[model samples]
Each structure stands twice: as structure tokens, then as C-alpha cells.
Target: MRREEVVAQWQREYDSFLQDCMNRDWAKIARADEPNRDWAIMFEVDRSFINNAKSLLFTIENRLYDVLQFLLDKGADPNSSLRRYNSDRRCYESTTPLIEAVKIGNLESVKILLDNGADINFCVERNLSDRDVYFNKTRIRVKEPSDDLYIKPREKRTDDEKMYIWKYSTGELANMSPIQIAYNYRHDNIVDYLLSRGATMKVNIRPSGIFPFPFTTLGEMLRRCKLYFIKEVGLCEERYYALRTQVREFESTKKLLKGYEVRNAVPYPFRIVSTAVLLLDNSLEFKFQYMALYSLFILEYWNEIINSKTHIAAYAKVDDIGYLICWLVKETEYSKSTRQSLGLK
Candidate 1:
């Protein structure tokens, strides 16, 4: 009957309302008696982000990407993240949704997070021994409890120092990033998209002993192709998809490389064509065996066709390399007609 009791009851109702929303049961959220609650907590911190008191955005991060867009549109903080937690072990974990998306090779969700300003450099928790992420927080100190002892909780360390330490000792374990995860997962397209959007590839990565990498985006792809060939992995699953999108992305990549205009980089496209050709020599059994041959003619004649002033100007210039290649092929038919009329070979 008292005002405090009434507020408590309302809080309980709102909690239930939020819980439903977190589960993405939109019907239940809409059916709630509290009409204002539907949109009210759209901007509130999702304290239940992890298990309890973690984050709210965790709700739709991976599964309900469209719902995530709605929440972002309605003013949810795009940079929301939570410290890792391992409830089974009752310890902290590093399970941010972006990292999870990258791990799972979900390009769409990864792009959504990155497009909305998710931290691409967000490090995966360094659990070299598979230790709990928050072992430091769990580690009990001397409890000096005074400024004269170690720096007090309220003072001393700069914000940067107060957090994220031991980066160097940990190797790439401490610097695991979204692009690194994508590359490791063989989600080549996600890696390229992340790089184009400014995710740095220079960070130290896991198994650093393997290759001291400072690879450019395309360089990494080519490097991966080389590794696959050396390892004799029968077929890269991505090669199938790569055949569908690589030439388009590859042309776009060439446009990007021109920013440097390094003379050496001029031959980089040719090398990719050649690399595909060499890989095709070994076996036709590899998945996407067709791309190697397809890429060869494109490279061998791209300059000749584009530069010869041969009247490809009639086809639609949609900025699509695939379309351009098809158009070029079609132009050859027209050239044959003109040659026949002129009695040329």
C-alpha cells in the first residue's frame, strides 16, 4: 500500500518484461500490460548481459541480427560488451558476440557489428593453459587496503594500465582480434571486408611461431592458398565460394592496392592468376577446379581488352568485374563478325 512497495512491484514487472525482451519473445514483450516498457529499456544497460549482471545486447547479438538492428536504431549502445564468464567454472570468460561471430565465420553478423562500430581490435581472452580468464580478479592479494600499500583502488594507475596487462608475454594470445579470428577460421571474405574497413592485420596472432605475418589482405589469401597447397589439404571449402566472388573482390582489391602504387604491386594481380594456374596443375579433383582456368584468361587479356580501345563501351558498366568479364567475352563475338566482313582471320 505504501509508495515504496508500489515501486518494488513495478520493478518486478519491468524485470519480467525485460527478461522476455532479452529472449526475443517480441509477442510477450508487446503483450505486457506496461505499454511504455516496450521501448523504455531499449537504451538501458542489459545487466543480464552474460548469465547475471553481464549485458543485455548479448540477447540478439548472434541469432537475432535484425532485432539487433532494431535495437541499434532505437538507441542501444553499439559498443556494448561484457567481460568473459565461464559459469560452469564460475570464472570470467571472453565471449563477446563479435568474437563469437568471427569464430563461427558468420560474415553477416560480423559486418553488422563492425559497421556499427564494434571493436575490431577487441582481444580474445588469453587462456594459454585454458585457464579461467579472470584468474587475476580471483587471485587474492595482500589486501593492503591503503594508498601507502599498493595503489588504492581509487588512485594510482592510468586507465590504460588499470586494464589489459601482460600483452607482450602472452604473444598473440593477448592480441587475438576479429580479423585474426576470421582468417584463422578460413572465412576469407570476412577477413577482406574487415581489412577494407580498417581492421589492422599486423597484430600478433596465435601460433605466431608458424609464420611471422605482416600480410596484406590479398597477400594473406594468396599466402593461405600456398599453405593449403603445401599441406596438401585436398580442397579449401572457401575455394568454391571464392570462385563465385574472388574475381569481383580481386578487382576491387586491385583498385585498393593502387593507393600504394608500388611498382612491385603491379605484378601482384598477375601472380594471383599464376598461382591459380599452378594450383590447378596438380589436380582437377580440388573443389572449385574451374576458377583457375577462369582466372587465367582474365589476367592474360584484361589489359589487352581494356586498353585496346576495342568498343566494350556499349555494355553496361556496372562496376562489376564479373559483368565486365562477361561483356568482354561477348565483345569477342562482335569482333568476329567485324573480322569476317573485312575478310580478316
Candidate 2:
């Protein structure tokens, strides 16, 4: 047969396969998109790449896990990737079948893919623009009228490093691994499973992976707590005095923390930060206590907070502690010397 004839035949087979998928015909869907019996060959006809879409990718996208496994068993490339334009980020995102499975929260598919030839650490690189760098640096979160917080063009970065995202200049592309995507979507099972399978986390970590939600920055997290208290708890000036009285109790909390360090003979910045994080929790009965502990924590460790990127919230880009306190927390009682000591201008 001529080359044209062969191309026409393959197109017909692909169309037929797609139709079978639509018709929910599992038997027909088992057939490949090519006329030839080489099941491993990815279905593009006549030497054409054709957008890099593959049958395995499609099966994963459509939640056809059984079909996905069938293809993998038939020697399909487990790591076959597809590239598509992400309209929200205004950039091209390249993803693989495993990443898609993680997105859909299907651990079975994830395990199957990993059991096959899928690369556990497969990463897709997207170039970060100037705006991306800026947003990550400033840690800005935009609030909608619906009272929900979101950031535009969310980018994932390494969780262990400090301002590591900043090291990437404008137009610098960064790699986001599969484990990172799992963390972003809150698929804890997948994360733990990946870890068990020796999947490395050096390449994964969202803006606020340590927090309950994907908050862009520490300031954003604090703002969320403030808004929740004001809206749900009716935070008002009338309660300020009572809140202050409750805040005095933070002195004991501070002393307890200090005694912990002295007894252990080791400084625990993470322990301190975690305690501070709990103070911001809106589920607490006394939401006002966040004010006092927050202030005390800053006053006690402002220098350590600003100087060490690895100590506290690295993704928050907290280059200046004093500015963060004054602007986000709105503290007014600090004197010039006190503010100066806290690194406030």
C-alpha cells in the first residue's frame, strides 16, 4: 500500500478508537490507535508528533484506569507526556500520565504507573516570568468579594529552601516534580506513598506546603486569620480590652517556650514557628490570643526571624520582619527604639 493509503488507514483507526471511548466500549478501547500491532508505538501517524498526546495520557485524563493499565501492560510508555497551554498561567505546561493520575487523586493509577516504567521523579519545567518572580517574592494573595483568598498563576517551589524561588530570575524556568503536585492538591496518601517508594522531595514544595492550605505567604496566612476572626467571631473594638487581658497570658506561653529550650539545651525555631502557627488557628476559642503571642514572638526573635530564611516560613519571603508586623499585624504600641530593635524603619 502507498504511504497516503497507510496514513488514511491509521486516521480511521484513531477515529474508531476515540469513538469507542465515547461509546464506553471497553473491548474496542483495548485496541490501539494504529493499524500495526506494535502496541508500544504511541499512535501518531506518518512520522508526525501531533501535539504529543498519547493514548495512555488520554486514558488517565478520562479516569479510565483499567485502560491505562492495559496499555501499560501492552508495553505503552508509562512516562508518555502531553503538552498543553494553561490559560490561567499564560504558559505551556507539560505533564505526564502519572502527574495526571495524581491530579485526579487516584492512588491506584499512581501505583500502577509507578509499577510500570513511569519515572517517579518526572518533572515539568515552566519558565517563570518577571511577574511570577515578583508575586513569589512579595507573597501577595488577592481576595475576591466572596471572601475567599487566591493567588493568580500559582507556582510550586522547593519547601526546604529559603527564597529559593527568587534565585530564578525572569524568564527562568523551574521544575515541578510529581511529588510536589501531590502536595499542592492535598493528596496526602499519594505523598506518603511516593515517599515510601523513595520519591525525592528536593524538587517539590508549594508556597505554603507546611500550612493547611496553599497560602502564598505568611502575611497572607495571618490576614486570613484576621478576616476569619473579624467575620465569624465578631472581632470589634469592644472586645479589644478583653482580648488584651487574655493576651497577657502569652507571657507564660513565652516562658514555657524558653524553659523548653533551656532544658533541652537546643534552640528550636521550628517548634517556635509551629506554636506561632497554632496561635493563628481560628478554631481556638480565644482568637484574640494571636495578637499577644504574635507580638511577643516577633519582639523576642526579630533578628533571627529576618536573618534566617530556613528558620521559619521560607516561601513567605519575609525579608523584613518589622514591616511585616507593622503592616500585617497593625501593632501601634511599640516605641521608636523598640521598633528599631525589631528592624523596623
Identify the leading candidate in terms of lDDT: 2
Q: List the residue pairs that clash in candidate 2.
A: none
Local lDDT at 342 for model 2:
39
In TM-score terms, candidate 2 sits at: 0.46
Estimate, for each residue in 1-345, the C-alpha lDDT of model 1 and write its tens digit.
555655565567667755765677766644554344333344442222122212224444435676555455545554555566556744444656677777777777777777776777665554333454464443321111121221223145556443322233233243456766675566767766776777754333222332222233333323333343323323355764565364455545453223222131122231222223323333433313343324333433333333222111112111122222222222334367643432223
lDDT of each structure? 0.43, 0.50
Off by over 4 Å in 1: 1-62, 85-92, 127-167, 170-173, 202-345
Q: Give the distance in Å from residue 285's predicted Cα in candidate 1 to where it truly belongs.
A: 47
Q: What lDDT does candidate 1 reach at residue 232?
A: 32
Instruction: List model 2 lDDT by residue over 1-345, tens digit each.
Output: 555666776667666675665566766655443334343234434332222246666676677777666666656777777777778877666788888888888898898889987899877755344356665464322211123322211133234221333333222344567776776576768877887787653231222221112222234434544444343334574674466555556655664344223212213333333233435445333433453335434434433434322222322223222233333243345578754543333
Prediction 1 TM-score vs. true = 0.37
Residue 303's lDDT in candidate 1: 32
